[model samples]
Target: MYSGRVRPGGAPGVHELARLVVMKGVVGPLATNVYVLRDRFSGDELLIDAGAAPDRVLALAGDGPLRYLVTTHRHPDHWGALAAVAAAAPDAVTVAHEADAPAIPVPTALAVSGDGDRLTFGDVSVELIHLAGHTPGGLAVLYDDPTGPPHLWTGDSLFPGGVGKTHSAADFTSLLDDVEAKLFDRLPDETWVYPGHGDDTTLGAERPHLAAWRARGW
Candidate 1:
């Protein structure tokens, strides 16, 4: 179990939003990221991507209720622990995009679509941004804190060096276009991106590389 104020190697540390505390840890053989978002006021928590080691993931929730178990996408590595975690927290609602719901291993209570659909717990609200192409239902969560820059939880759609890998040239183009228009075009440079795996990066760090990524064809 990992518990600390910061992750090593300069990845994003524990971030305090307006009313939430965010912590991240690597889980599963694929090293998928599992993020715990705790509402400081209500002690309610949301677990993002229960990829592996259900016991370890559940332990991270502490004494608060696990209100939501969110699967960023339908990939096996991203929801490998969903069954176990959902069984443990029966009250927690399972969430995923409607298009990807059929592919998920567990039953999802909330099949969300469109952009700006909000899920609130206590005073914290997370908005869903639809970013298709990586998958038909690819999505990223946007945490808009009144006091800090927005935090984006991009599943595998957007990453540090480039967008997620696609099955074809058309898919790659689609992923890149959606990412540029929905994320980079709309959010500020200071927006922090926490991808499904690996280190975190900011929109500013990736903005200049758009053309390079386009030329490389993913």
Candidate 2:
């Protein structure tokens, strides 16, 4: 029963899936949403987007064994607290797309380049789907839960209303095409979307507006 009602200053919310658990909190000056996913049985954990506020990130990580820290994109606001979190948990492997690795100051121990790159922890498997536009190496994390709907964590590539911002029409087209084919085409409507900076939504909620989003040329 994830309420999907998190805000910058509000309390964090936790969602439980079949074999995994996710705790979400909005942190940093930009109010970026940080997600801490843990294995329900093994208690091993991985974090998505340190955002900022190291103390808050560590607190959300809790006492579980932090196995990995996956950054969705190359945005500064997205991984602001990555260095601190990685330092705190030296064992946690830093993961990011190879294309954007140069932009991120922190060293990425595991640079995933493929679309279906898998990061397995305990019994849970997370897939990294690359969506280029907002950034050449931007990526979206997909966790197709065994017992529930697929959960997608889109960094800045997508939101509740439309795809992430782009600098030009070409950039917008790149992002839109990738999002549509890779995400909308493959995943079901019930897939839950966890964006970088706002409330949660489902792909089904935003599917009908694909044409509108494209025509706007944003």
Candidate 3:
């Protein structure tokens, strides 16, 4: 048995010409936050980490053009909803890094993702970044424009206070370095960071904690 919460007002369903509504699925004991990125101007939506309640994903999507199902990692809690999501959005393509590609139940429609891979949803653009740490094939997705900092979907590889665990390799120094270089170092300081677990945070807030997390061997 698992527990989860539904966000109030449901972020934004459909913004105007320049509005982007983000529906967050606060689910399970983990409080996993699944996001539905919708560009009201174009009537298109992109889903990120459908780990929360399946119903929440459907409800948030409503009648929008559900296009992409992006996963940050292969963890069940993160990509577990792949099957359910496929059922709801049949035409959606499940995108993940090659390393985590096998985790998706329906790999036939799987698209190979990697650092610098660009994607689109209506008028929104998504970029993939390989931020392996919590798992051998962990991933992170970045959305960008000429506006502000890029929005990062940093799986368990990174959170507000720390990075994901290194249970497999028994060491996380490399993962820490990856985060420092590939994520924090490259992204703008004010980037909006939406993690697979816990509440949302920013690159600026997470940067200072990097040294501490690395020191702890996370």
Candidate 4:
């Protein structure tokens, strides 16, 4: 039976790009998808959201020295294994948006602000787009690969069918507004969205339902 959740023993899959390679693995009781992005040329890597199973996450990283551990938000599901992963890579710098830095359990060595801020490792570069509402400092990592469509790691902000769950109408509005302006309006429809959980989707697939999502007021 398909429960729509990533269960334990779910194998990590790899997507290779011209300059980067992404390894996706599921962890945590919430089934958070932890992504390990590596620069093909330099072998530099970045781990996004160490949510659970430190051993599994570390194994997927292989022998490469992790340069950055980026926590998209302060949610427990996103950082469940953060401490263990950080301990494994003692030299890796922890990164988070300044707005949510104080809430992060681990020490954030780099507090990023503004959409223009970019993080680079070897030839791979990722642009950080701050999308609030899901969390005050929720960030979506954008990788503009020359070989393929742009890749966006949205965390819990934007998902396949709709936006992430929000507690209030105001919060939902804020998230929807940010997604439309910063993501859908600016990026191409072909852009690939790898969310915090579940399967991946494209912006094009979800573009038409924007109005429907708003009408329901979820």
Candidate number with greatest lDDT = 2
Question: What lDDT does the true structure give each of the candidates?
Answer: 0.85, 0.92, 0.72, 0.89
| Per-residue accuracy of model 1 over 1-218 as CA lDDT, tens digit each | 22222332234346666688887877777878888899998998888899987876777777768888888888999999999999998999999999999999798899997777888876788998888888988889998778888889999998889999899888898889999999999999999888998878889999999999999995
| Clash totals for all candidate models | 0, 0, 2, 0
Q: TM-score for each prediction?
A: 0.92, 0.98, 0.86, 0.95
Q: Which wins on lDDT, candidate 2 or candidate 4?
A: 2
Ordered from best to worst lDDT, the candidate numbers read: 2, 4, 1, 3
RMSD of 4: 2.7
On residues 88-204, what C-alpha lDDT tens digit does candidate 2 reach at each position?
999999999999989999999999886989888777889999999999889899999878899999999999999999998999999999999999999999999999988999999
RMSD of each: 3.1, 0.9, 4.4, 2.7
Best by TM-score: 2
Q: Could you give me the TM-score of model 4 versus the true structure? A: 0.95
Score residue 26 of candidate 3 by CA lDDT: 56
lDDT of 3 by residue, 1-218 (tens): 11122444344323222456666665545666777888878879888887756776677688878888887777777766668877888888778788877765656355564578877888787777887667767777777746655777788887778877786445487678788999888888888777776667888988877767766663
What ordering of candidates by TM-score runs from best to worst? 2, 4, 1, 3
What does candidate 2 score in Cα RMSD to the true structure?
0.9
Better of 3 and 4 by TM-score: 4
- TM-score of model 1 vs. true structure: 0.92
